[model samples]
Target: MNQAVRSEPGPVRQTRFSFGNPPRGSVAVVDTIEGIECCSEAIEDLAENAVHPNPFYEPWCFLPLLGASDRKRRLRLLLVHGTNDDGSGAHDTLIGFFPFEQKLLHPLCPVHCLCPWRDSYRWTLRRTPLLRSGAVANALATLGRWLVAERHAPKILVLDDLPGGSGIIDGVERWRAEDRRLCHVPDMHESHLYRRQTDAEAYFSRVLSGKRRRHLKRLRRLLEDLGPVRVADVDESEDIDRLLNEFIALESSQWKGKIGTSMASMPNGSEIAKAILKEAHRRKRLSLLTLRVGDRLVAARSAFLAHPGCFGFKMAYDEDPVYARCGPGFLLDQEGIVRLHDDGDLLGKDIEWLDSCAVEAAALPLSMRTEPLPLHRYVVAVRGGVSEIVSRRFHRVMQALPWRIRRMSAF
Candidate 1:
């Protein structure tokens, strides 16, 4: 079993550092939401021009979360800045944004560590830092150097759910090569990713086995027998508020509600969902698909658009026996994938792929219709101290635990 942290730890001490002989860039640590808000404009700029897009990290979604978090006081924001154009000594250009939370290694012990900031809601899937285009290597190097230089810094740094082929892993590897004191240990797993090939018909034919195709067809037929079935996609003219409410209701009527895991059931869960959806809608980066039978909404799925890629966020379906037998969830997923592949005007022509964002076990069915993309969690140890050795040993023990236990211990 994992050690439970009862008392909250103190905030990360704020610090600033300027890198390079002539000072090429600098890193500033902000430990409060208010402090982070002061840099909102720069943060948004960095997000817009980031080498990789992570809608989860965008200010619209992130700020509200930080405001609602119970551990907001323990959160830290690392802002990396580059020198301005006027050749003045001022560092105005925001090159990177990395958010972290300070936590105790164990409740009984005082050893502290830093992990990527995540809400207790567990809604976000990606944790990659926002790095400006053409400055990824410098940003990563500056971050590494700052961490190493901190006198009271935590020995362990944990970054979870970093997608594969995002260039971050390579950058980390190079940083480690340059400094042998940082022990980099990574754990990898695969998630489902859908990349459009030919047309929807041809693509599905190639990915779906004959048996599975027939089974799905049978399910669709069964669903239609109840009432006239139709698929709908949320459009620019649609009422987002009503649709979002319907989604929450439809989702809450199933097992999630009984288990208190549904948005409507959890504390502030519905409000958070609405806020995220609204933000995405306002930015014209939201995609919602629903399946209906004779006016009754059977299933719905939502995704956030980060141009060139989409991240599947959530999905829900009616579980009443009458509709459950028809597999409305799977049907809706098929329809969504079909539309995503065929309807260019709907998701925009720039969209290239969709990440299922489902865990390995939950992604098995999706894997049949999509490619596997590896995702990783990196646990790093900053050497040269007894605390570092303790952190390394702690991780070694944790790694020896069973997968289920390890997952439960993850925070």
Candidate 2:
């Protein structure tokens, strides 16, 4: 077990939070980007052994976001460390890593809360923290106790967009069960997931209806009639900047660009994305696929690779009226599925599934080709107070409202 240390220049203030004497573990808070960089080695070790993999939380993807100049919120990291069994006092093993932000639950509401950190660009899709396998329960307990002991801790802890069946949920449940004072309200919704159970042909045949498959075939034929259609994987040796520029340009030509929501439109967005992709490529965790008609690129998909799982991060398709009928995006998805199952060198044979990383409405089109994975959001009272009562009542009111209204009023 490597000793977690902060070796960055200047005074490094480490604050410890605990209930009574430290039991088997302890929690340390690091609020600065430099402090986080100093613990990169330990964090990377925790990522490798985490109970579940979250590519967005990995240093390669997260560090660059922290350094982005346009970032609005201050992010703080909670580091949970496990102590050795020996009598010697040494908190040597890194057990958990949770990055969060403190803010008001809503502008209309006065209740301050702690939530999983999100960047101004909204790139992170998963909020699950990296907890060392086999130590999830202890890590959760340590974190909970720390929250309780901290003098200025928020009344509520809201974790949103956590994938269903995540260990974080189970650990939180166990901790809540032990501490009955904590009140929790959890809500779930479905997302898209693709598991590679068999060869692509067989898998698609099993999931896609005959009529739908025929329609896709017809669409492919239409594309072929226009020109030669091919699905190609971006060569790993190609320059990352050039590939990213192409992707950004393609995305900016679509509706996102018209609405001023494209990556190229956001402040410092292109630079942050380039840094993230460059780091991911350097770490061998990037996979890019494209669909081209003759000489023109129509659709492209980018995914991040974590061992045993891949996350579909960003995708863009030519929105030209000419190519709309060909369903270039769907064609690209079909090809991507084939490559995931057949092109071992591209995605690696070890990867078992691909998470679309999209919301239910956005993922509806892929429902036939993929399975529905539930995602959850939980609002829990870390320490009972006026804020807790207001939050619980607000949640109850939202639940009683219609789905659309609830969504509109969501915190």
Candidate 3:
């Protein structure tokens, strides 16, 4: 495992409240981002065993995001506590964790857009032990209260990129059902990337035309003949530095570098990626695949491993498009996918799903697993007024508009 990364000391604001039916436990509001900033192992433990596992929730990804955000944005963490029946509140266990950005609320403006700093809206709750019945729903109630009462965000909270039948979704629905006049609409969109069955070789063979498969095979052979070709998966702390350098250099050679968006082109982007990779490495949630000829890296991919799934974080290939014509990136993907299906990782975690975290109309052939991923923009008003009427009308109009226009308004 990589050496643990630490966050700089900062003032953390906190408040506690007892919650849940039959007194399951307390829910704490963490106004500052300090709670999970340095707790990689704790968050990893939750990711592995949470009621609904989201690989992106790993500390490696979110903490770096928290650090990278401009201080102008308000980041808060909601923590659910579980403990013994005694009301003393001693030895409380952390039963749930979710982070949120407090939106800028203008009193007269009902037409404001609801958007997160980054794509983080998952309410990750641990499975029941103390609260044996409906733990997920219970946790969401606490979180909902925190969002409205503490953070003072619009009652119409916009949650993004949630899978159907997720516990968080259930919890939100449950709250809406019980709470007075609480309404939510689930907006669905197709994320072109989803999970497929295990056999990589079989899937690849079935997807490609015979002639195209042959061409890829021939190109693979040609690339191999260049020198001693090898594919390596690095998870230990040792090889992360190599992965970072090779990936940045490879990606920089592409259009993203010229546009000043690639990691190599932006120093802040590079550091956040580095911190996330290193911390994820420590918790054994990172996988980096390198395709090399002799000692030269030809292609590389960085991914996060967790919760019976793998997420495609980033990818890069050789600078020369002559190599691109032959699809060196595809070659790396083929090798890496096969290896993952064979073993998953050193621990043999069943990597059931490969979440592309990508949009519709993508090129990669990720066989559909569940329903099309729906990116929802939920809005609920605190009370009926010009605010509620204007907010609903604006959101309805926005949703009815063309996809491009609606997307532009979201920013």
Candidate 4:
């Protein structure tokens, strides 16, 4: 194990270090956004002191899942720093990532944080306040400088949401070609940002236009006949798990007996959904959301809400034969949108239009359309031939597909 310890000059109370060389396998250094020590050390302190539930990236939580794979050479960890640190503590540790593979398939360079948390529709450092610190920025800049000096030649360095302070790194190229902005070292195609106007009323005004919205409204009125008609919007950390299961059930039903794919048809997808929600909730990010109707969970939607935009994740409704015509799924989404507007007022933040990840013309009628996140994939000489070829082919195919199909996909 190799260690690099960094301490503030005057106060010796805090010091940061990289514990081990991941390539060496015995021990690997976890990437800390604050550029401090790996999460293993920081999380220990938080777990011991904090009363709140452990965040998804908490060292004890991720280490076990990642430790075994450290030897594989594919693991890449980025840490998000929390506020507790002397500027060093649990909050001091930011993002942690592990790439599925090390090479980019296309002409572009493929450099992405293996462990990424989505903020807004894209990924960013402030998914949690801890990741938004100056320490994390210093660490990233230092790391980038070191890599450039060492001739690592990474084609791209994808910092999900660019966090803050990403522009200072030397030798890295920054691009803003797609839906969002990304910082990285240059390759064939420079990175680009995704920018689009989200007009919520324009998107959903259509839903309210036709009998579709009216029918659902009437369904609610009729449902009131069963009892008191009510629309409940839930956005709490503790309720994440239950809502997730409800989503899974709805998703599964949607795919039941289908030929190709459905949300519930896939294996372990449920677990993946929960993991993401848990992480997003832990960060207090706006990615997780759920809308329930009286007693029986009716609709569950997971989305990423950024300053000027929101990305819709999975949205499903419990299938009750009796209420099928009511379009529980669509109705819940309508209510969810309204709740978002209300929350925006409550929080005093701008309510940008919701991004459908991809355009679902169906959703367009409801208010969302397709918006793609700019992607700069990098391919290098050292990456295996097979991997590169496959990646390029995949990228090409995806780029060719229409937005609606992509929006329904769970990649």
Candidate 5:
């Protein structure tokens, strides 16, 4: 509702304004790394201020996805700009950047630009700075308005893997095209959250029950029987290259290797892995950890850190099935968590929490976690009034119908 209009000096003065978009504002789409690199300063600034930062959205990671995107489907890299009216003239400041793929409403449906598409992983959390110092809501509104103008607006825009307390949800609360959370525990989005407490014991107590603690201890003892096991943790950029290769090998040794889907297998997977890890390293946000039995690497955990919070991206183990019986993955996972806690601020960023980024079914080495990471799925419509009154009627009725009857009827 903050639609106050103000005057500007030059080309920006003629820029159209509506909804939360300011009068002196404009929008553009950037679908390439060259474009992103051009705005590196602004993009980096946004990353610094990003809420619940997701490295998947980083330029390097997206390089492959953009390349693999369907030619028929339009890839959108929406950039919102705010015009600053200095006495001399008007200048545009990069206020926001949103990336999404546009596709048909349905395979057979003639409608185009029904909404944005997400990948199979659902790593679509709010990585961009949704909570800017100011103009956050205005930036979103500008994007919304543009979607409407271009007929790219969906009746409902769904966002997957939204984290708890995300600013995106907060920003959309007041929009006529509102945001709503629909929680589901799909393996792709579900992850564990370990927040460090007083000490290791206390933290474990908070996350695990007495019985679970005993179980993990027994598993650790069995694993240690293999050999003298020790954890090596590093937040250093220099170690990422070697650590990355180790992780890929461990990951590929099992099903990932057989299926040729591991980071070391796919065409761009290695490049993406190297690029992201290297970038994360350069930004001083990389964490490479391993659990070794003598000189042999049994398990590896690598991630990208964002100050107090670290997001686990990959957890791989040497697959021998004997180690599986011994719980090698869990052992390393447990050590990695404790390493983050014990090392506390050694790197100047006190590890407060680790988003396990695990599938819900996988039992970690440390069964006792502070909390189950809440993963939320949500849908935001272009025009709330129209969606509620028109588009959602059929869905509402279908939902209301008896589940068994509907399934039997195949409706």
Candidate 6:
């Protein structure tokens, strides 16, 4: 616990919902305001509706949502509800969102999770007509104000928005003037988007070194010598079990993975994959991409349609050292991206990119998502003058160690 950090105001409150404000807790509680339970379902819907091929946030990214709210007593979540305009009526829709309180789980992470002051949690709000700007921002304010009285409060609040909309720029402007105690996270909502000429092509062009291109080109040309090659997308079918099993097999072989290898690295990973496929057909924007040379299927890619954007995942390519010269892995990826670009089903006006990396391909921009999903983390602190001083000294000493040793050392 850090003594320098203190509690701050929560979000704005609205009485119109007819829901009386729940009893405010003395300690921060980060619980779902809305859409937390259905996040994964929402991601699947987005993948099915993407007009252009781009990676959107996946629901699984919010796995921490399943955690207990009080675990991090100092952390709190503020979920702002967006309103949508529909012919039936205007209703609250889960729209653009960003996280409020964030704390680094492991201060020594070598990658994105490394920062000592990582307050930016997963936050999101719908980009479509599903949610309105004023309502969401007001709700966020209400939530912030509610946390003001807590004995232990979050030191920083992370806010994220795509460069353009989400009403975040304006929201931040309003949020700053209201409270000085709450600090904003730097580079909070800056997101990244990668582009290719076509959606069906492999997106790794950015990462493809000149030497890699030369080698890949020569390899492809050699593979072409074998015969005329072809690529295709898998059609929707009730045979999801068959398709998934085949996909897992193809993916494992392509990556030198086996029953006990990476594809099955985590029991939950395979379960999530299977669950996604089983529910794919039910979702309009969700689809999978696969590449084959005649009867031999060399690779497969899965993507979710997030209305204006799509999120691609689980890409695997079979590697037969015998055909190593062909570069089936690269070929499959290229074909998948190209196909996404060409697919008529994924075109729409409000086109946008979501998620930092859809495929995690070297070519992916490795940028943050345009909008941040509202996720929460709990923080606990020591109180009183002596406790505060000791806490500060302890935190400084703790953060000074190498990341690896710190992670393994534990709190």
TM-score for each candidate, following the candidate numbering: 0.90, 0.90, 0.78, 0.49, 0.76, 0.57
TM-score of 4: 0.49
Off by over 4 Å in 5: 1-25, 31-33, 64-73, 83-91, 108-110, 113-133, 151-156, 176-190, 235-239, 343-348, 365-368, 384-411
**Model 6 C-alpha lDDT per residue in residues 57-111, reported as the tens digit of each score:** 3344333322312344322333333232121213333333333334443334221
Model 2 RMSD to the real structure?
Answer: 3.5
For 1-411, candidate 1 gives per-residue lDDT tens digits of 111122123333445787777766677887776677777788888888887788888888888877778853577688888743233434558888888888876553467778788766777677778887767667767777777777666777777766778776676677678877677677788788887877778768877988989999999999999999989878879888999999999989988889988888868989988999988988888888889999999999888998788888888989989999999988887887677666565653577788888877784346355677788877777777766676556666767877765664434
In candidate 1, which residue ranges exceed 4 Å CA deviation? 1-14, 71-73, 83-91, 106-110, 363-368, 402-411
Positional deviation of residue 316's Cα in model 1 after best superposition, in angstroms: 0.3
* Model 1 lDDT on a 0 to 1 scale: 0.77
Candidate-wise lDDT, in order: 0.77, 0.76, 0.58, 0.40, 0.57, 0.42
Residue 116 alpha-carbon offset, candidate 1, angstroms: 0.6
- Candidate 1 C-alpha error for residue 156, in Å: 1.9
* RMSD in order of candidates: 5.6, 3.5, 6.6, 10.4, 7.0, 9.8
The candidate maximizing lDDT is: 1
Across 1-411, the per-residue lDDT of candidate 4 in tens digits comes to: 234454443322222233223210111233333232334465545333432112333443243333323344432343323232133443334322222223332323343323233312121212221232233333333343333332333423333222122222211232122212222222222121222224345445633456655676787776555554456444562566776677677666654416424444544444544665566566554453444445666556665544444455566665676655566666665565555555453111454455444332344322422232232223211223433344334445656778764443212
- Please give, for residues 1-411, the per-residue lDDT of candidate 5 as tens digits: 222222332211112333332354556664443454555567566556654566566555555455544445455566567642221223266666566555543343333332333433333333333323355565666665665555434444444565666565555544433423211111124567888777766776776778867887898888788888877766553466777777778888878779876777766567666776777677777777778887788887777786667777777787876577777777666666566567554322576887776667767623646777666644344444544333334335445767764443211
Reference-based lDDT, residue 81, model 2: 83
- TM-score, cand. 3: 0.78
TM-score of 2: 0.90
Between 2 and 6, whose lDDT is larger? 2
Q: What lDDT is reached at residue 223 by model 5? A: 76
Better of 3 and 4 by TM-score: 3
Runs of candidate 3 with Cα error greater than 4 angstroms are: 1-10, 19-26, 35-45, 82-93, 104-134, 145-153, 192-198, 205-212, 235-238, 344-348, 365-377, 380-383, 386-391, 399-411
Tens digits of per-residue lDDT for model 2, 317-348: 99988887888898888887787787456775
